[model samples]
Target: MKKTAFTFLSVIVVMTMFLAACGNSTKPSNEGKQGSTGNVNQEAPKETEQPKQEEVKLRVFSTFGGTDAAREAFAGALDAFQKANPHIKIENDVMSANDDGFRTKVNTDMTSGNEPDLLFYFIGADANEMINAGKVVALDELLDADQEWKNGFAPAALNFARHTDGKIYSIPMTGFYEGLFVNKALFEQHGVELPTDWEKLKTAVKTFSEKGIIPLSGPFDQSHYLIEHFVLAAAGAEGQNKGLVDGIEPNWEKGLAAMKELYELGAFPQDAATIDLSMAGNYYSEGLAAMILEGSWAIGGWKDETKANTTVLPFPAIPGGAGTGKDVVGGFGTGFYMSTATYENAQKKDATVLLLKHLTSQDTIKAIATANGGTPAAQGVEPDGLPQAALDGFKMVGEAVSISMPIDSKVTPETFNTIRANIQPILTGEKTPAEGLGAAREIELANKK
Candidate 1:
């Protein structure tokens, strides 16, 4: 669910108090959208020691195309950070999200002993590997020293940061919550009273389909997305499904109920089975889809395309429990991680610390937050109010269930393949919901063996 700056460098280089660092100047690479530098502070922390007057460089591993407006804004923030520190130089290296480029690059670097000081990575097995190997530094001491940074975040907001040792390896980029992104005008035009819960959502899908509108701009290609939706729906049925406040795999029944409902609703496209994450935004934009269970990241897409008015809201509250519309399904955005190895030199380490501190400043976060159409992570730093729809979209991310990110890479490749290929059948009605769900789960279980 996240990317930005982090490293996969060969485990941590045990450093003494020496003032010099290890020599890899090149940046580590990423496998998703690359994003680079910026500085912001909700509460100012002491500027760490500076590197010597000699030229110093900090590498950036990001997902941004690096030439886009958003990237430009981030770059400007880094420029400002350098100005404040007067010693840090930044080398921004961009990478592709295609296939396993990011992951491959990270694995190769870590095993090769040449990992970049900072690279973008997701939290799960990928991070666990580095953390387990004792390559990454835990942020506990830093958080303790800077109470402000800890205060800036919501409790449990950075849970993914925990290493096997119960330590924090990385700082969370930003918090994101997931929900049903519905096309308001489309639903109204089709006389589908927005769904309030399981029954209502199903009925709404049926209503939308009857009017020739596909009810879902599905992410069946991201098979876990389907599982997430069904699970959420079943949780709603429980009146207060605790598992849903954060995405969870409770009894498979919850997910089963949700999928069965969607299947019967006939809400997805003819090729729902084939749709991937990329299509979710586009489908909604083109008016080919009525709803999508996506994260706030799609807000930009809806704003950028589509003529119909779009508004995202939480999935209908489950009947009777504490859940219904009370929480979300995702978590925050991206952030950067510094390499203790690269900062080995006293001077380099000082500069790196200053740059890292600057990157999280309020001014920088505000700019990046705005350009990407994101929410500011800095405490009390509010963004300029945009259209009502946009504001509501931001609110949706925090109001829904907490994020429970799936371990996409932990399962067997074959199981992952089946999920990517087979889940679509039920989504498109090519197979029964039970058959589709069973097949996918069966594969996952098989992989565990």
Candidate 2:
């Protein structure tokens, strides 16, 4: 009996040792997962680490930096874009919108391979040149990729945006309209009717001049607004298009001669030969002038009282002229372009595109249009709170048989300058209309080479 008891005690001791070994192994395995929670707390950063993102910097160059209404509108829109896109930084270099040398500045930069990521400029000849040089990106694919954004643009605007290659490099923002901004108060004060036809216009000019008030305030030496109006009004759409291309139309001579006739009739201010756009606009705004042949861009600068009494109407028909009396000189004036480098750079491509979209978006463009008193490139832009003069200008364009682009825009810079320079002499009887236009045509032909 004693020997049996010893054997049972030995078995019990072995069983206890085996059970202890199993518990030790199981405890360590369970602690590895649960104790890891504690370890995770200690080394928390290691599990949540993320790759750093590089900030993208972009340079934007534009001509909307002056004290004009468009300046404030563009600045506000740009600020909004920056706020929405914090990761992308924009450095804007703004120049004067009226600076004729703006194109020269852009040309110098383009030739030196120093282009901004984005550029705001005219959409026609220069835009086509940039596209041809591969400086600007063709946005057809980008536009097609987003139909909602594309559809927001008017069909006419999209056609205007495209180049001969059927690819668009620019996105138009606002359209411009040219007309006679008449001060109805001044007309009533002079006992003259608002001119809607040639005979009434002549009568009004005679009455206003006799009263010692400037009949029409225009810049004779510097601006092409008058030339564009008179020439397009005389040539009509088909003839104007032909004149811009092949040669100066016969009607162009008539247009130039008509200016002289008006000058002889005392239609313009005595100091019109020396005045610039600002001076003319000031005269009209101060109620000292009967009318100013200007664009929609000038509406914002009109005095509050004058703007209330202002009305925009098409240039009166020139007697025996070929133009449809209703045709106006105006079109999509300014557009934004993206650099090819911006598109090729993987870093800036997406952000630059996003910025361009934002700048040309429906809301932003409509705001710009409202601020500038011009038409929006986007469709369905409500004319909320638009000045009567502005609405009148837009109405004139809508009812027009066809809108003619500015003659200066279609001509070479040198030829345009020649036209501007000789206008004073032509109106003063120093140069014949035929002589002036012939000289301009020679320059145009030479420029074609």
Candidate 3:
């Protein structure tokens, strides 16, 4: 165990160093479209009897692998796109998706001034840095110009594509909810019906506790995804709540109390912060816990790992909650992004538009999601006849289009480090949640300044 952990840690360190090295600014100039009116260097047509054709290929760098289920599902769609555009050849490369690792590689590529024609990267949640750095192209013109395709997507999904500047960057890949993963057999064994609110949940958990079963499991490894999901659940159940805290930014305060409350329940294993993210996905298989608060990706992992009688649902409504039991808290996952650099290069720029348009089609998205175990982004591809709770959760978010909060991602990256390390101790009584949150708030405020 120690050896395995050491190896993982070594890889993480290397990726961190690699990403940090990418920040040196020696960027390449944008090559504006060759035939477009936008560039100052637009060339006049030569007096030739026949129009000359321009040749270009789009290079796609992905964090997705060809063998990945998502990629498998998307392969046919991509083949169709290639058939449609003979001029655009796609070269797909899969890189690591560890947050820091992906960031480092992309950062290095951008700083080298040769950004990918398109990035299959996380868009909305992680776009703050990319948008601020002007790495992402503003797609407002492309989107607004396409009234037909623009109306094809649900508005809630499109809302995340907009930057604070009100310009669009990338369309969403797919949306998911952070919810409770249940071991139905365990609840049945304990004779504890699912609890509808947090207090009753505490009772149910305690009942399981007496039988020597851990009631919940989580991974707080770095970003505190487990804890953060609980916060999102509480926030969704609480009126899709956003409040103005004097010292905090837009998303800082909404779910703090709920996170603290869950920590107090002693739900997770000891030293959960030090555990690997993959650990919680195995809980039901190992019989460690009754449930988990996680996203749809768990569906893929669990099906591959175990055959336990398991299911998923939205977090039970918070006691005295203001929102429905099915209220969900997450945004559509990111989509492909065009590079401003590609748009500027006359030869390379037109290739960017062709590929970007093809990648956003309903055909491509549905195939990718079907293979990847997510509910698809296309309007007609929803999950059918699952638990009513799962269906309700999915529909609620579609209707409300709740603001997708990047609990940890929204704060500064430096602040991310501070809170990531401290979440477990603070949640489990070693430190008060208020104190820990205050420490995080301090770092966040400093970063903003």
Candidate 4:
């Protein structure tokens, strides 16, 4: 009986040793729990980790900076984009629209292989060079590939942005209208009638000048709006659209001559020759002047009181000219263009397109239009809280006989600059209207070559 007990105890001891060894083997080792850096962690191996997203940097050049009415709104959009895309960085390169150097800068950058990833500029002649050189991408395919995005834009807006080659290279954000913005309060105080025609305009100018008020708040140097309206008023839509290519239209001469006639009657500010568009706008905004020739974008920059009193009218037709007197200068003149470089770069292509989409999105278009008092390019989205002046301008557009794009869009930059350079000279009698148009014609011919 003692021998049997010893054998049983041995077997029990062996069984206990085997069970302990199995338990120890099943338990995880401290060495396996340690990472390569010898740090203790219970996480999975490095091979199972998610890869980091690649970083992308893009540069977008636009006129939505330096006191532009839409500057803040555009910056807000950029901020929102960055927030949504943490891995992408955007360089908001901008220049003021009023700065003539901005045009030179854009042209220089485009030709010097320093093109911005995206460019916001005029859709017509201003972009033709870049488009022809293939510096910018034709967005036709992109638009077709994304129906949701394509359908978001107004059909007319997209049609207006199409290039001469039957391809779309730009995406419009807003449309604009230029007109005679008259402060009704000033006219009422002076006992003058609204300048709806040439005779009434002359009477108002005479009365305003006699009362020591600037009749028109426009600079002779940066006389873009002045030139546009006068030319449209005299040349009408047909003659203006013909451009200087078919030789100088007689109505164009009449347009420039009318500017001189207005100048001699004390229609401009005394300091108009030295001032720029911004200062001229400020004069009207400050109530120092009764009227200003400006665009829809300028309404937002005026004082609230001035905005409240403002009303837009079609620039009156020049006497004995071809204008219908109801024709106005305006359209989808500018838009956003993506650079060919950015569109072809595989790493940046997607990000740049995304940024472009964000910028031209319906929400963003509405925001920009609201801030700038421009016609939104997105269908079914109207700008809210617009001043009376803006509303009046829209009404004027709606009732217009014809809406034409600005002359600057039809002519080359060099040719237009030549015309602008002659404004002060022509007004002061240093050059005749014929001489000014002749010089511009020469530039236009050379540009075509």
lDDT tens readout by residue for model 1, 1-449? 22211210100010010012325232211111112223444434458433346777777676544222256766786777667545567877666342336666776776677666765566544565666565556667767876655665433435445654677666654444456777777777766787656677878888878878888777556655555545554444232222221323444444554565676667677766555556655777787888877655456545444523767676664443334454445434355665657656665665665555556655555566565555455444444534455556655543333334442434444544564565656545576545654565676565445
What shift in Å separates residue 192 of candidate 4 from its native position after superposition?
0.8
Per-structure clash totals for the candidates: 44, 0, 8, 0
Residue ranges of candidate 4 with Cα displaced over 4 Å: 1-49
Worst 10 residues of 1 by lDDT: 8-17
Order by TM-score, highest first: 4, 2, 3, 1
TM-score of 2: 0.86
Compose the digit string of candidate 4's lDDT tens values, residues 275-359.
9999999999999999999999998888999999999999999999999888878778899999998888999898888888888
Put down candidate 2 lDDT per residue, 1-449, tens digits, no spaces: 01123332332232233123233221111111211234445655766754545789998899876646678888887888778666678998888766667779898887788889999888765555677789988888998987777877766666666666778878888777899888998888767888998788888888988888888898887667888888877877667766544766888888888878888899888888777777878898899898889888788877899999999989976777887788787767678888888889999987787888888777787688878886677665553467888878766765676676777667777777888888988987889988888788888888677
- Whole-model lDDT, model 4: 0.84
The parts of candidate 2 lying over 4 Å away from their true place are: 1-52
Better structure of 1 and 4 per lDDT: 4
TM-score of each: 0.70, 0.86, 0.73, 0.89
Compute the lDDT for candidate 2.
0.76
Provide the global lDDT of candidate 1 against the true structure: 0.54
lDDT of each: 0.54, 0.76, 0.57, 0.84
Q: Distance (Å) between predicted and true CA of 282, model 2?
A: 1.6
Say which candidate scores most in lDDT. Answer: 4
Ranking by lDDT: 4, 2, 3, 1
